[model samples]
Target: MKTIKNENIFFLGVDIGSTTFKAVLLTPKGKVHHTVYTRTKPMPDAILSCSGECHKCGRCNLGAISKTIDDFLASAGIDRENVACTITTGSQIVDGLVDFIKYDAYVSEISAHVAGARHYYPDVKCILDVGGQDSKAILFDEDMQMWMSKMSGICAAGTGAFLDSVAAKLNVPVEDMDEKVNYDSKLQVSSICAVLSATSVNKFKNRYPLGDIIGAACRAQARTVMSGVGELFLDYKGPIVFQGGVASNNAVGYYLKEITNNEIIIPEFHQVMGALGAACLAAELYEKKKKKDASYEEKSVFKVGVDELQQIIESVGGTPLAKKLGGLKNKLFVHKSDNGLEKIGIPSIKQVKDAIGDVHLIREFTDIFDKVVLRKPATDKGYFKKSIAMRANITRRELFSRNRDVPMVWRNLFYPPEILNAFGARTVTLETYAAFRARNPKKLQQCFDRAASKGYSAETCSFLRVLEGDEKLPTPDFAVTTTEPCQQGERIFADLVRDYNLENKYYTLHTPYKLSEHSVEQLAGGLRESVKEMEKAFGYKLEHDKLAEACEFSNQAREYAMQANEIRFTSPPLIHGSDAILNALVFSPGWGKPEFVELQKTFRDELIERKKEVELYTNIEDTHRLVWLHLPPFYSKKLMNFIEVTNNAPIVYEEVNHVGWDILDVNDPYVSLAKRILTVGFLDPELRVKKIAASAAH
Candidate 1:
């Protein structure tokens, strides 16, 4: 690579985002010299034919970026020789950029946005940036003087792309979307998904005026941001700076101001804040480097060969290597260090590997598992905590163990574990396994990609997608699923059976929607048939005595679970609901085992002991009690900790932890299991709502 020298008169920053290309030039004194912003364009077929071998294929976005830079320099009447340094940020910064433009440093999108906002308003405490592909919420801790950020998940809801889709569908120009807004519109757009929201807009276009539908879409975008990452702003005070391309949308700004009820500041260069921030960062770093060395060259910040750039582009477009290079380029430059003052250099290869690889994650979990299973429980710690560890240990040993001698059964969580216990088979609950794998995000994403390659739709339930992507899953002797709760579960199971050539061994129990004697008998008949099929496949007779024994164990476990729930209902927060929810075995295949019964007993006893001591498991004071409704993302605990520890809000109960059914009749195990499945709180809408209401009253 060639090194260039400059006279240190100007600094340049470029942001190559998913939807747009942006550039900003700044004078030595921090004044904006020039700026350029344009839509990002893809490489044309003629240019792509070169397969990136052409060093200067100016037909692609890279070429556009070069042109933008050239125009920026000419328009500002500045020469490259006078530019002290250049910094780059955004999603596509490293996509063959080294061949076109050289950057002295690179910064993350979050840090760049913060720098840009602080340049204009140093006291800005909160930032909500809704870009083309994703949204981010950044908060500045006054005491610590550090930046904290939350980003949206894989969904494109509330992003600029979502808005563009709605605009295109409504035949409204992108720039005119805000002007056509109906502020008082009472319509609603789905905030859960971008596709679904677009579908809603399509449906509404027929019934409602264009303005109302567009306004609802804008409101939905605001709501989506608030629900996903804006949870940080729940108790935040002071002015919030809204940055990014989407900030240009006045309707979104209006809805955000109305929702947050705070002063919203849109910087003079709102759409180019990231680029401005990068320029600011470049200026800061260049001065520091010159001062330290007395002689510093403007070296290329990123060095990517043709092959590496090709791989990066391919990964960005969702190839198998995507997870490996995802978010890596952003880490290639010096930026604000952990102390929030000092600048740090490039990260090591091992650090990158740890960030994206499953080895470290698996090892971390292994250490936890070893600590729980290999050592004696500490008397100082609550047994409820120990019980959770024990439950995890049981699950790890049973489901994950490779013991081909025992029949391996693939079953959904809704199916009774007691039936499999009678046959002495090891069970892998699809959802549970997915949750376990979710601990390693990169690995889980690989599974998702694999599933997508196998023709699974992106809209499929994430858990099922994970299963479909799972190439390491052991082939099961048989697979069973129920039709209740999740219809996708049975369909996915059938696909899995076909994939594994287990056609004769697959079973689906068609569970009825409503609970009645006739429904129970019908389900009971399906269960009986399934059991008979299993017996025939395994070449073993159905032992009534073993079935009855399994039911007795399940009943015992249920009693202990109920006792634990009663204690939780009456006492102060004894355990963090985050930890409590890990007792997934309560709803999984452990119910029929003696070890599960012991786990339940220990849990109940620990809660009783905690009640007597007047001690809270969470050392933090509980200012607010909350009931968690659904599953948490198993990938991270940051959200849970933020709620329970940072906000002092304790999730006292989780819906899944509730034991709502009565003891099973051991003599009539099939009928009892069928009744339990039918009456599950989650299966019945009215019952679920009533149970949630009753739990909240406690």
Candidate 2:
């Protein structure tokens, strides 16, 4: 029997690109530790805290960086005993032996920008990176490695500082500049640089509005940037990534979209790419350092911000990136690939390949190729296989059988995305689906190409044929389909809101079915008992049978429990099998006529009580104001009591549009008595005595 001993390991990548420095820490199996960022400022503390990782190997920094790392480690409560390795990048890396070592290894920031963008937008062949000081345009083939590269090596015109300078002079806060430009829809500022543009704006200020001037500036900046991108490639192959710090501006994003006639993807952390790249690089290096120490650990994903990491650093006194270098010396050995042999130590290529196994390090440092370690003896890379729900977008509650049974027929006719938002579900079109699908490797290159050129759809995204094989994307929690009915027996219509306890959290949605109407009606009997207290407020005595019925539904609405086609009764005239029961419970104050509105109000007030709800109607404030405008004449708080019936006018009644009213003469003999009687306001005015029939019938 042969005995084999293995060490635990990790890897890191430290990317010091043009604008920023980034550090990434990952296990040998590719689990990321943390990603940190700091601007290009020469703060020694920031540098060391960022790159001087731990005590895997010890060496002198550029003095300032060393101290910064030492102080930061002290502050982090970490002793220099745990880290196994460290890597450095950025312009400052030109210091000493460490400088010479990584200079050749140092990658351009553009690579990470391209790589990460490729991570999100794989179809990006023609790409432009517009940043703070300069902008770079790169044209690449399908794989996204640089095929051609161009730069605005000398210009402050289309940069962030340029925007900041103009915005400050315009009396706008730097952050507010983007919002202001977005709102200004008409201004045309200068594109020719700060001095010339300022002159143009100042010269035209007397005749042009400030907004128009700003709008002009916005357009000019967009034009200048597009011109730079045009210098790279004219026929714009996408997904066009608008990366770098300036990409954070929505105005810039929108403007680029209009100019290129191409969609722009401003990723969530576009401003922090340099740092993310640096972090990713650092993580790759750390994994190499760790390979010297421990043999194995399953890869894991974790979430943390900078602050949480501070606590980790503080826990170990700062040193090298290892278990413990001397005092915090880590006992792991992996050969160096190329970057870190001199400053601390490097493992030869043979030791690295033997220990950490196979990892493909593409020269640019963005694309990482890792060999899958098989626990179950399978060579399958799970990356390409994921289950995604593809018809459309579904609500969280729509997973139920009841709601699923309710036809999506209405969804096709008038699917207000607002309804999905209201239901805590999202509604996305095929375009988003296409973009999301691009992340799937099974999708062909031509599919993305055509979608980018002609726009994506089921007609486009799914055009390649083969509806035959079972190809899955990420498994979706729920799927929303369009035009097709749900699978039989799987159709759900249960309103999760009514089925769940948190009704207020879902106040915006119609009640979901959680209970049966019959079960709810049983509780209505008990609800009738509470009606005694509600009768006066409602201006009517309760009918026990009807009141009991309302209670049953209300109770069921409170408790979301039901099956497919089950009456959740979560909402009225909706969310259930029927509304006839509640509709019957509410009666109009008028005889031979029905006041649907009053019945709705009465039923709701009795059920929900005086508990103040947020925005009582969908239209909210506008609807409330309209209600006040249509207030009854009998309820007039402004009418003078002593005024006699001199001018009867038209004797208008709102009911005229519905059941309607008859006209009364301007000088009727009994006008005074009739008008005064009308003032008290009967519960159901339309059902009132025949003497005062609808006076203004339509």
Candidate 3:
């Protein structure tokens, strides 16, 4: 009944990455030990570096790679011979070993990297590992299985090597990045490939301070990951924990933070995530191989001669037999159940480990039933009772409001923080967060398959995977790795159009506006229309949706809602009268342009006598004759200073969308202009719509 993680046996693991060499010893309980790392030296150097001596040989430098690990273990007084298992990867180092010696099981380089990442962020849907020789982002489902894996082929642009290269150029110690990257200003870096990025950084040094440039270089590198590795990914949740050696740079983390509202989690053991996975893998194998006599051990060997290896490989190289063999790993199967069936895992420790890969890498949901803990206390209740209660909601108990009745966790995840400062972005509504998580699988596979059907390779259609990650797509009923005993229906696409425009589509050529006596009615349509325009102009939609059955955060929307609330509450109150409306009337056409509010005192007095005057009592409470425009929250602190310069006339936020606002005395002529605009909506709905469209188009 004991779990694999709870066992006490130990294991050994080594990751020989294209950029660096890493080795570690791990207990079955997942404790890491005797870890070592060195920039990938030549193979001969790598072998020699593991020796106990701190000496070097001719024609090569191991650069303290293996020795570093041996010394660590020696210092801890651990005997090397006592280690139970050893597994190797990175640069196909173990691929050659498989032909000469037998391994309990062998894992591909992609699997090892994913396993490492999963150990740190179990809910991580997409993992971007930027290493020395190559970089890749592996997309996994909610179950922590690799839905698809991709590599950067031979790009050096976003990897840690770029950082090291920059450090070399800047004369900064590689280890001292923390101090050097403490930039006061942003340093521009590359936008394209690595070579270009370096050039950009160098050119940026002429005009800006070095610290600022460094900060920019950090941003450039972070963006490279997004476009390079993360570009193809879809779903990027439960949380993204950036692991690997490159993540050690705090600035890179900061730059990445700018793009993702989700706070990046850097594990305590971030740099050693891979080594730990390897060691844990070794432990699983060692524990599974029981002690036996010579005859029993002989029985464990593969029942084939050396020629079988040649035969098996040649079959994979292309004859009819090879084509058949290549496809053996990807056969489709079917499973049927109410909600579909869950996978029944293999019993062997090695097979299970590979199947599970490094769920520990993304840091598996430490406990299995985590997602099952719904946002409420009813999660533990029986289905019948839950269903009955859910169906029993009384219409009379519901409270009516323009605001959305969504839970806060769901709220915070979708809205961007900026949106909240603008009615908190609450009157703003889009898709739900839960739907987005459920639909991720569909988003990735359908797009991937469609792209593949055309000209796009798995690598080229990576954006689908990115979307899936955002949605926390569910795992396929059956993945390629572990074959199920029975067939399961393949994952399929949903009704694309219905899912895409579920909010109900409206058609309009010119424009429309809602006009009413209510003050809320006048501003609401303008805000809504302006918001939709923003969406189309950007081609970016950041709403949470309930897809099939998954739940995720509509974090962008939640944030925007908060911003809107701030804007609504912080602005000035109503001011009106004939004299107040006539004194000032001038406006600029662009956003952030200079606006001046000048009252012609002599002209105003003569003009006031000619026009009919109605007194609007100053600071009137309810039933005031005039409507007032208040300063937005962001402008409050600034206008407070402006108020001192203006001798206490309240600064008014403007009605025009783009023009900077104006400040006016309650008795100024500009007040008349304000009253005319406010009453326009109530004058006529049809005329108002035409007027609004005409004004907005300009």
Candidate 4:
């Protein structure tokens, strides 16, 4: 440690890296006085609370980082007034810091790292640094002249964050890396891409021990670093200083030694070296200013023009990436049938809707569906696994490309899907379609914005907000709605009818709460009128023969549903919760349709066959079976997989599965149809609860 000419003059440096923030205090001689290092987000409670207020004033960035610095200073009992100058360095340095504390000196992170490392190891010829999200290497020749520098590109492989992510997946703490990794283990991971490496890690996790897997990950990270740096390491260099957060990992150090064949020196505060470097640079700047007696304006180069970019981002109320993605309008071409229900190529309107998230982070449902589900063989057991592929094909051929000579009906869950099926009409559930579009949280927010802009109440269900804003759905020739599933459905239906000017073609059923004979007839009359309305609207007569035939198909589907439930309740369940819910997604929306009935038969027969084979397996264990009430989340299929696969708690039954499956009376069609809707238990709140409880009891 060296003393400066001015003892009162102190230099403060802040390094705000992608994953963590570091603050350090140094005398004019660059001797460290205090230091702090921690993650950037999930900030310390005090800073987070201050950020809340700053966020209200559009100064959150300053409030958060400055508060963190303020707390760090307080911990060291240092006053800001004693600091003669302060400097900041990082990839995300912004002008907002000037407004926070009037500290405007900004140094590039690369310069800071070099200066910081040179302070401890003056003879060091090269620096290897791996931060949270990126990696870099700098080399110099014998004359101390900078020769080369290389950095990992946008891919975050070979970085501290990448290692942390893999550690989380393996259920191992990142700090335990030194003890967990077996250097002698021969396991290897070849992918240099962070996303791809994660997939590899997950694949090998079950096959390899934690120690060997982490060792492989470490080797892969080392290989990735060497690959990024290219042949620059081969140049003669010794005393290579390893800085940045990843320097803390001993396994990474071991692999680096093996690759570089050079002694790697890790400084005492390796994780906060960037901040120390910034402080050293600040010390130099302070000394120069004192000797020259010149006043250097405290300002950042980026601060001059950041206001324009800030305004642009604020105008859109999101990151630039979100705005750019939101502006994109990609069209998907499809072949259409006359009925308008039949179409090819456009499976769901969401497939064409612009993805809503960070450009790099967007995960399209279509990609996952095609690669994971659609690519699965048709013979795969379980309804969701096999039937989803089956249903997707059927939906494209029958619903999208089917004959549409009859009038089409757009309805909600409360309305029985069978009546529309019997009338030879195409039916689409508005809620289900909205659910699909709302899978991504950002997209859902966009939908909510659209409805809110039109003065729709935010208190309304999210699905309804999406339905009100989504205009891509085909215009139905007639709308059939029931009055029992709370007032929300009726309100949404009325709004849609009014918006589309379909007042003359709308039918409503005021279904009864009780299942008595009189209530049944009252409900039955309302349904019968809906059938007559369809006839008048389409200029076609109601055929009693077709109605009876469809009822028989409904009975067969119901029979299969009962058998499927029994199979699920077996000791070691052959069916997953998602499969059961998926069956309802297909059947509840398309009950009485021939394709749905056949799919049900396929599911039932496959389960019966699987049961026999599963019984032969001695290792199978019965998992906790939870009954999910109401509809399954339509946003992401991965969530279901997490619950079923990761948590191993499979839902055996969903309330929606009971729709139109309670043994309809084929002889008295209208009365039976009315009874099904009332008994499905979605009509009333208390009844739905009781139905769920009863199912759980069984």
Candidate 5:
């Protein structure tokens, strides 16, 4: 994937790491244009730009780097064509960028840093950097030759993580931490671990002054660096350069100077030295290459305009349907709002349904999902809004894949998608479809009107009404319903089957009134019969081994959910309410599928990382953590964000997330699954009340 390029003007370098995504814009002569050092979501969902104001939330995996480049160019007032060459250096490499953005060269981090440092100070002997996660000390010989580069290993004791955690514990803003140094205090912090250091500070806060505790923490961090790579740092010659994100801390820099007894030089753009280095290296390589290849002339690197690419795709196959799909191909399901946030803008239910016919559209939808819903910085208002839109986008694609490739079952939320998944079938739950339709209010009203046109009562559930009116979505070959959880869904499903004249394709799931052995056996019997019926309809056998495998994945997804839920307990909770709810929606119905499981795991891992960061550095106080008793409106994110920003009240947990089936025992598959359904809150009203009360008390 290439973009329009020019030989003159700017050279670009991007460095994406676990904590921050840094970019440097430089001229061919190595003069800087603009530089950005952005703190990422600590997850895969990369933030293109999220200052106190504008925010663009997107996936950080495939298109992360490319989007960063595009946004950077746009923000810097440089046309993509004017960028001479884009270079990349980072720990993680995204494949989506490789196809879209043509990089002039890729260099190692050490080499880039060396070139960047040398450009500024020709005879600098050593470089010490304390970044977000790791710390590095680069040693140079008399000729400024690279000798040894020692870095903090897996432990992040002396890095930004440690300082951030301690700062939060002391109720000091990270920017103000250095000013709180009390050098007169004789406090020694032995632990370099973030949590441990925070614990140590918290203990001393009562016995000592806040400034003194911060002083001890800073010294401890500086000492930890000495312990890790002090020998080489001390052995290196004079004029050492201290750079990286943590180098901004005057106290840490001052301590290093005292300990090393050397002149410490902090360069311009110290926080983003790695990115600057990468840009300098790119500029050097581009100049060298142009001199070596006399015939090389710069050309546009763009693969093609979106419209042109769509045309190419259409011309290869040349059909009316192909052409229509080609037109829709370049358009993303979500659109940007005036405030720079993304919104789900599928004009109507019919258009989204029609898009399913083109496999390209399905692929496009999934590709934009960013794989999993990302956890973004709380300060970015667009983060959660964009996440909601992304989830809604995926819901449509999943519906398409189910209708086209597998035996589609129109079911309700209470009915598990796992049963259908076992026989290689797909489910179109009422709640899921309704959630998608919520993006467009006019379409929602049309759906309601359609339900009334079909002779359904005005009092019918809104979810069922939307499903009844949706004529563009492919008709399901099979349908399943339950009697207890929601009577309206069963009644509407029955009416739908009758109206379509496909009563034989429908099945009624009977549930016992209470949680008893007989009830479990009854549910199991229903499941077994449903599986047999599905096998007959889909022309596939019910392989217990496969069912067991799906159950294991279901269990794994449950485990991940549990982990994420635990992290939600952190102050200024790391996981957003919308992200948690969307994650539950992903797994509640489709937990058995590998993709759903993978997404849950990704979301969970992101939450864990966020928890680690927030627990350490979040300085916000008086946070009011709220537990929502029921599901909020999926279409409107304003309510959630309003509560979060205006009132400092973040919805930490939703009751529905806790209602899903717990970890399953694949060994006794039927009984385990039977018991899982038996535990649903609606089946026992007492359990729902108790669970809700428990959440509130916490």
Candidate 6:
């Protein structure tokens, strides 16, 4: 082991999580000198003698965290000045150590765990950390020299806190839970929800032995971790390092081993791995600082001001018009600093290029259209693929472009776009916009963080959460939503409208769960009411002729789409399922437009040509035919590509593209639109299953 030459220097790490606070002190030789671990919200009696004054003493959390660090240093026989560097991590680290304690730096829980794991097991390939509040899995890709992580949603089912709750209910100490396990027990508890699992444990207490229930609960924890973050271990090799508070449970480790059929290694200090990792980071950063390395400075992605924006534009070889546009955009969107502009950390020219490439939205749009629409034939991209990409880009351009001539209506996917088109409006479908934004992963994550900061629950749909976090969403003239498959969609849309102070412009279609004539009539009535409200608000009369024309265009597009589907079903795999699933505009806003009809015709014609070509000489074998249910992830194509290209399993059909509804009745456009909305399978579980089964049969 390498040792630091400065014997007097020491490093400290503090991890403040939702349930616990941990501190680790390390010597100059990088060995743990002392450690402290305690609950974040410790009982007053546990910290000191209780005079029952804690209720009014709002600083109990802060006191506990400070006491832990103080005691840790005192026990180590080290003074605060002797500690060369200190770093912090965990969920509560940001706010927990504000006044009393100061830290040099902070790292994410995932990064901390990875660093800690690598300290002991340098070649570690995978890690699973199940803490009190959340769980995480980190996989190291040696080939790419990178790490990828997956975390549990805002749920406590698989976490240490959940197990502790179960232990308390069973009248058993959490430490002794592993010892009381009855491995032969057949009782299985629900791993999906913590509350439901607790309820199950309570119900089973009378029927089953205590040991059997404990065993089952432990098994449930392991299963939950496997189903949640353990998803990343699918392609993992070698032993899995298990860390965090939950790793102390031998029974859970046993089940993890059994489930994965791989070795599981629990570090001696598994509970404080995050703190250890932080300490390791502190020592490394301190060494860099000693050498006066510029890398020691903290780096973060920031919203650029005018000057930095200009530099970025010039770095990317921007045109004069582009530079002017960039400057205008920066002034409008980026925050201006009254102080001197902060220097951006440009590590290398490539990084500068990547930064500019990631955020140059207009440039990206121009490049995409130029490649897919203008240079389609030259690039060897199929006509259908080109058409899909072009249609998506066109919709994005229309929604994003500032067109003062038309009202921009924000709508849920369930609302028909044809009506908005008739009213001379551009539409922004929430899901489609989210998908478009997802093209830039870095920006999308910023949106997620922003949403979290705004108190949006992590359990909210990622699509809607993306919208909540998005500061760049175009202000809508009005908004509409449906109370059907997704109530969250309605809630979020309503919140957005409230935020924009456009209460009167907001509209919602109350869709019943079951489809019937009365329900359809009720929906039609709602649609008519919404149309009237829009007409009054925008000062434009609803013309029946324009609506009828839009519906006719939709009908023509529907015919072409049906033909395309038939060709896809009967013919060989010419189009990838990934590409087909992205034909979202068919279900999105512009179905009523002539361009959509042209897109559909081109799609159908391309499929026909591919079918003829395959029939002539190509002998493509039918491998695994998959029917994709629900929506594929919009953020990345890795999973889809792995299945289709790597595994040779073609996604034969997708439920989203299944044209199940009938052609719109142009004469009775409102009622027809209502009926079409009602027929959507997603609104009804039975209908969705039937559709899935039918698609599978093909």
Candidate 1, position 232, lDDT: 83
Q: Runs in model 5 with CA error above 4 Å?
A: 1-394, 402-405, 585-587, 616-621, 659-662, 695-698
246-362: candidate 3 lDDT, tens digit per residue = 878878878777776556777776666676666666665455433221222244321222233234435335433344323432221223558876433222222222333333311
Looking at candidate 4, the ten consecutive residues that score lowest on lDDT are 296-305
Clashes of each: 1, 131, 102, 7, 7, 0
Write down the TM-score of every candidate.
Answer: 0.49, 0.35, 0.38, 0.45, 0.44, 0.49
Q: TM-score for model 4? A: 0.45
TM-score, cand. 6 vs. native? 0.49
lDDT of candidates 1 onward, in order: 0.76, 0.37, 0.41, 0.70, 0.67, 0.76
In candidate 1, the residue pairs with backbone N, CA or C atoms under 3 Å apart (3 or more residues apart, or in different chains) clash, namely 447-469
**lDDT per residue (tens digit) for residues 1-698 in model 1:** 11224435778888888888888988777888788878876545325433564353566656766767887798889877666678888988763676677565567899899989988887788998888989999998878679999998888987898898898889889789889899999998986887877788889998998889989999999989889898888999778999888998989999999999998888889989999999998887766544422211122222233344344445235433354454554544334666664534554333433455654332222222222221212233554667768877888976788787878888887888899988999898877888778678789779888999989888899888888889877788888888867777778888888888999998998888877899889999999999988987888976999989989998898888888877777666666677777675436689788898898998888888866644312222324678888677576666775566433466778877877676898889899999888766257788677867886876
The C-alpha RMSD in Å for every predicted model, in order, reads: 16.4, 27.7, 28.2, 26.5, 21.6, 17.5
Candidate 2 lDDT at 431 equals 21
Worst 10 residues of 3 by lDDT: 481-490
| Candidate 4, residue 197: how far the Cα is off, in Å | 51
Off by over 4 Å in 3: 1-9, 42-76, 92-105, 120-124, 142-145, 182-187, 291-698
Candidates by lDDT, descending order: 6, 1, 4, 5, 3, 2
- Which residues of candidate 4, in runs, are more than 4 Å off? 1-385, 397-399, 402-404, 439-446, 585-587, 618-621, 637-642, 659-661, 684-690
Q: TM-score: which is higher, 1 or 3?
A: 1
lDDT of 2 by residue, 1-698 (tens): 01112224323345444445445443434344455444444433323343443333233434434444445445544433333334444434553434213222344556555555554456667566666667777778546444677777477777766666667567776556666654545656777685577777677667876666666776777788767556676765555767776776777777777887877777766765553444345444444434422322212121222332233334333422112222211222322446753333332223322433323221111111010111111102221111011111121222222343222211211111222222222222222233344544555454445434433344421322111111332222222222111221012111222223323321111111222344234323322322332343234553434323333332232222111112211221111111112121111111111122233333343333211221121111111010011222232312211111111111112221121122222232123212212322222333443323422211
For candidate 1, what's the RMSD? Answer: 16.4
**Predicted structure 6: lDDT:** 0.76
Q: lDDT tens string, model 6, 1-698? A: 25788888788988888888888888889898888878766536444443444323434556666667777788889877778778888988544354456566667788889988988998898999999989999998788689999999899989997898898889888989998999888999876888777898989998999989998999999999988888889877689999999999999999999899989999999999999999998898777544422221222222233454444455444454355445454334434477845444333322323434533343332233222222223114454666867676767666687777888888888888889888888888877888778678898899899989988878998888889999888888888888866788888888888888999998988987777899889989999999998997788897999999999999998899888888877765667788788775336677788888888888888888777754432223434578888888765676776566533467767878877787788889988998888777378788768766886776
Q: Is candidate 4 or candidate 5 better by TM-score?
A: 4
Candidate 2, superposed: residue stretches over 4 Å from native: 1-93, 96-105, 142-146, 201-211, 281-698
Model 4 root mean square deviation, Cα atoms: 26.5
- Pick by lDDT: which candidate is best? 6
Q: Residue 167 lDDT in model 5? A: 76
